[model samples]
Target chain A: MIHNLPPGLIMILGALLLPLLGQRLSAWGALVLSSLSLFAFWTTPDFHTVTLNLFGQDLSIVRIDRWSWIFGLVFHLAAITASIYALHVKDTKQHVAGMIYAGSAIAACCAGDLITLFVCWELTAVSSVFLIWANGTETAYRSGMRYLIIQVTSGVLLLSGAIIHFQQTGSLVFENFLGLEPGQRGAISDLGFGPLLILIAFGIKGAFPLLHNWLQDSYPNGTATGTVFLSAFTTKLAIYSLARGFAGLEELIWIGCAMTLFPIVFAVIENDLRRVLAYSLNNQLGFMVVGIGIGTELALNGTAAHAFCHIIYKSLLFMSMGAVLVRVGTTKATELGGLHKSMPFTTVFCMIGGGAIAGFPLLSGFVSKSMIISAAGHEQMFAVWIVLLIASAGVMEHSGIKIPFFAFFAHDSGKRVKEAPWNMLTAMAIASFCCIAIGVYYQPLYDMLPFETHYEPYTAAHVIMQLQLLLFAALAFVFLMKANLYPAEIRSTNLDTDWVYRRLLPRLFAYIGKLVRLVDSLFRVACLAMIKRFLNWLSKSCSAQGWLGSTWSTSSMAFWAAVLLGVFLILYYL
Target chain B: MKTKDDNSKGGNSSSDASWLERNVNVVIAGLVIACIGSLIAQLWWAPLFAEKHVEASHVEASHDDGTHDETSHDEHAHGESSHDGASHLHPAEFAVEEVFGFEAMFGFAAFVAVVFLGTGLRLVIMRDEDYYDS
Candidate 1:
């Protein structure tokens, strides 16, 4: 029965126990439970499935395949690493929420049916919001609400899409929607509304193009360690879902291109280093989306490989920035500088992460990202290939140079802080090691791909070309800096898509509320004036000495009664 | 007397500041040197290595095809080349492989474009930190 149990159940159940256990015990419990789930994933045979008949439909709760395996394994790894990093946190609520969020993402990855996917998906949205709220600031509270609304909206879309798809096809089985044969691509217009809705749902989570505002809006506001966990799971899960359900959809190519391109601009102007990382995270997802859109064996492999590598390096970068936030109490670029003199290990780890993200040679990104670009070239999509090439350099600008440069090597801010704690250092070291290992010895990663990977990453030409791109980008940074053409880091907020929701929508609602209040008061005053006039008339006519109030009232009343009775009798007779 | 003391203090602090500046300059110079070295290595050494590998893979692929008939050999070679072109693991043949410093030039151009693009965007959307505080 334990073997047959869903892989994520252990973590969810473990989360429930976190409150009962002491803080130290709960942290240990998270690591153990996460490792146990990882062990379960590995031990579970390929194509191993557990089906439950619920509501007259067979729901696949545990569908173990190569695709799900990679995502589930990475989720478990992220959970363990994040738990380790958060060991210093005393807040039990964060611990519980983090474990549950990781569990839900894992459950979603393994979910074989749309209904199951939707349930786990919503659980992830619900549980992850607690991580944001754990900051216990007003801004964090507001951002958490916004994050929750967007996430839950994604879940609602997924549910609606699932229902529509089920009604149309009479099946809830989650699989690729396009029904394209291998090597075939599908156009966006060819998609039904149901799948398109689901794609949009994934798009929101994946931080796709314009729908990506929630990420930059909320991620920087999360607790230091919570952001680390947040960075690893949610968007990557969306990418996994997209690769699973909508691979080879050509529209994703342009969407992916826009996703990669637009964030670079925002990241360049972003003051918060963590927010910069969030934009960088969006840019990285673009590469994966482009791969998924390409929908070839190599491209799909690239998507999977990139996701695996991105989770490691991105987590490492977040952990480094998180360490900075924890030590210095701010990740604002204006406030940080020359941290390497103090937090040397973190800087090194961050540099390694930056190098990997920039796709420098002998780093994980160089190995994984080339697959997609190579796929584009082979397909002769010249425009997309060129855009990707440009985006590659753009990634180097923010994540590669700007992040490490401003945070660690720029003007010293005179704040000397101690290095990060052992637990955090260990987590970062593990992630950094993975980044280097995947870059240098990528054969294992390639072999683990869902499809057979024929591409090699360590080619002389590929390595040189990538080095040329990265180094020349670095050279541009030098030139710009010498010329003072690079934008100066300033403490300011830049308007992004979230501005519509965070500012404009609230103002609009307040204005409407004022109008409603004005109308209500006017209506009340008019009614009150009418009532006053009626009262005045009544007092004047009916008071003593007015009209029939005098001595003649008696005679008038009797005569009126007699006449009324006579009329009534006549009408009754008639 | 007070002014003299203040001047001495200022001089001492300035000296300390200069020391820090010197150390920072040294670090920057070292990094710049390393970057330039990498550029040189990429230009000089990488192409040679690439040529060797490309030739080796080409020979191996051709040998595999030689066992087949002429018609199938051509087809297999075409498939192999296409496969290599698409595969991430393999170094795909580029149309301008012989073009020296193409990646470097392209990278520089991309960086300039991205920076200009970012600056232009900032002009339109930049706001005070308190823009959202209200």
Candidate 2:
């Protein structure tokens, strides 16, 4: 244990120090320092807890454990890669904000207590919004606000749940609490609202089915590099927390399946490639969530390994898309075509990413994705196995082929653009290398899993079977393309399940508003008419309304008080 | 409001586009053949290229016993003996329940295929210079 040196505090201090130096140097410096810190503890023993005093109690801020390290390692890699990609960006606010955002996530992973996690969680929320605002567009501003509200609300749930958990369990350890002891469970349920609050907290960040609007709304609108970083840490952190807390919860399996399949439909018709990726990102998280729900040693390992591979491949895909957006001033598939001649390198990198995401044999996705598939078969979850298999094919269609095919290799749109910058290319190369390295040398990764198991990812039969699936999926794509049996991208919107909330709910509110206004106006008119009639009658009865609308006399007040007192006495007696 | 593409007159007009349209199939087929052929070749020549090694080979075999209930003391010790043939309802398999649904899954796959095919046809039907524009 170290004194006066928690990782969160160190990160907060670094965030303050960044803008003081030159923009490029400070951003690079922060990335290097954070990477070094991560390296320092990469192989540290699991379950290493470090404490700090907060509010007169000992609080654990650094929970060095297998899970935290798993997330921490990837977060650092993302930050470094993002930093390298953003070397040309001149926005100081975005740079500083990105560091703080990345730092808070790292700190959140290391946070051993609920309060510490909450602090870092909200910090990430506040800091990352600047990245969206840095886009300097009206769309980005609105989307940033939406992103902020949702994120802060998720943080609020965390705080509320932490309080309830503390009151019940009398401790605030941020580790697994899905299945508590009987005494704790009794206390938890007695609070009545504990699980509900915690679920909502994880739900928003986890992007659980219908609760996943903020992601599609904000991600595409985020600045190019901002989206790259956004792709990496935030949602994946929610997934990690879910795994830590809600594993083996059966409800999550169906949610995961829905997540995997639903997005591909929208992504296929979606004009914006970045938004397509957001949908694709949602689909990928479903797999991890499924693994967590399985909660077996193999399933959990699958979740972790998937997260690891997903980070690199997803970021690479994002980077490639970002390059297109930067050069062509758009990522709309309809508007993009045949840039493979000019941007050959970008195209190659994108194909690698697409293949990886599609779970093609020998790609990063295949090895990790199979774990979830096999887990389903092992459990005899016939429905789930079918869905996952369908999702695998959907991935091939949308991300696997559509992304690269439309942006780089359709009919030549005659747009001549230079390749991505040296730094950007370097970053892509590193990420692509990691993707292949992980795919090809999966044994080392399997060995590093928390579970003690011997799993063979490569065999003649397994490879042959995987090839059959992928080859057949590719054939499907070819047949579909040849036959014109796909949905065309239209200028109009394709409604998602979010339509119930985003469009339908708002329209409902407006309809209610109109009705309320109509009723209120009618009531006001009736009230005025009634008052006029009463006044007219009073005027006739009392001559110029002497006792009413005119000056009130002490006699009138006394008379009313006498009547009120008599009525009060009568009621009391009854 | 579909505009007629003047390029329907064929490749004689524009050198760049004609060159690409003429060679696109050849290039794509070449790439496909190359990627597959290389991967197949790697089976013998590229040991380091394969994603899995020997240790991971046994993981599927042992996964059943290793994942016996955490609450069941010595339950894992019984191994394959305790596992009944009929009821394979292990807790670890619960994760995919949310991840897989029949109608939704099949629907998404079919939808993606249709969308890709539709877009590709759209490109052919209403070819435009600025199809990539926002």
Interface root-mean-square deviation (Å) of every model: 6.4, 10.5
Report the Cα lDDT for candidate 1: 0.84
lDDT of each: 0.84, 0.71
lDDT of 1 at A394: 94
Residue A515 C-alpha lDDT in model 1: 97
List ranges where model 2 is wrong by over 4 Å: A1-11, A43-46, A180-192, A497-502, A537-574, B1-14, B17-21, B27-134
The CAPRI-style docking tier of model 1 reads acceptable
List residue ranges in candidate 1 displaced over 4 A.
A513-574, B1-98
Using all chains and alpha carbons, the TM-scores for the candidates as numbered come to 0.86, 0.79
lDDT of 1 by residue, A1-574 (tens): 6647777888988899888888767777788888887887778888888999987889998898999988888889889999999988888888899999999999999999999999999999999999999999999999999999999999999999999998888888889998864356899898888988999899999998879999999999999999999999999999999999999899999999999999997888899999999999999999999989988777888899999999999999999999999999999988877777788899999999999999988899998898888777667677888889899999999999999999987766665789999999999999999999998898888888887665666655567777778878888888898899999887788999888887889899999999999999999999999999988878877778666354565787899999999999999999
Tell me model 2's lDDT, rounded to 2 decimals: 0.71
Write the residue-wise lDDT of candidate 2 on A281-306 in tens digits. 99999998887766666677778878
Residues B1-134 of candidate 1: C-alpha lDDT, one tens digit per residue: 14355355435544445343557567667656766765676666544534433443443432232222222211111122255432222344455543667677888889988988888888889999888886
